[model samples]
Target: MSLEQDVATARQALEALDRACASVTKHVGETVDARRLRGDLSRVRDDLDLMAGQQSYSAYEPFAGVYGDGDDEGFGGAGRTGR
Candidate 1:
């Protein structure tokens, strides 16, 4: 897919994640696993924060490389080269 498409998809995913997190939050006092849900919500929020950053959205790939650790060297290369 194109970079624009990737951005749209990521935006949609972020929105969905936000909605799910909100729903979970609404159940804070009613659910037994509220703590677990809160943790999940936090994790999702962290991911959303990452997605909103330039580095995370720089390419279209799903997994990011560890720059300092040299683990993601070849995983990225101009996300949209042709168009």
Candidate 2:
């Protein structure tokens, strides 16, 4: 199949996986493992969304300032610079 077809198939599979995850969550309360799994699934779905253009790349975008020059320090800036 073509690349577009493969992406479509993967999207559908992700949708089905989402439904299954929901069903499992409903049947069994959101245990620790279940919550962790859900979090992981959410991240995967977000990635798929980014691939499908359903979501923007803003979250993954690079910071607009330097790291130690009193800038935003990107994402992992602890207590070194600006917020």
Global lDDT scores for all candidate models:
0.61, 0.73
Model 1's TM-score against the true structure = 0.35
Q: On residues 6-80, what C-alpha lDDT tens digit does candidate 2 reach at each position? A: 778987898899888888888889799789988777777677677766754535645444333555545766566
Error of 2 at 11 (Å): 1.1
Q: Name the top lDDT candidate.
A: 2
Best by TM-score: 2
Worst 10 residues of 1 by lDDT: 57-66
Q: What is candidate 2's CA lDDT for residue 73?
A: 47
lDDT of 1 by residue, 1-83 (tens): 87657767876886787678678668576565766766665565566556555443323454434354445335464353544
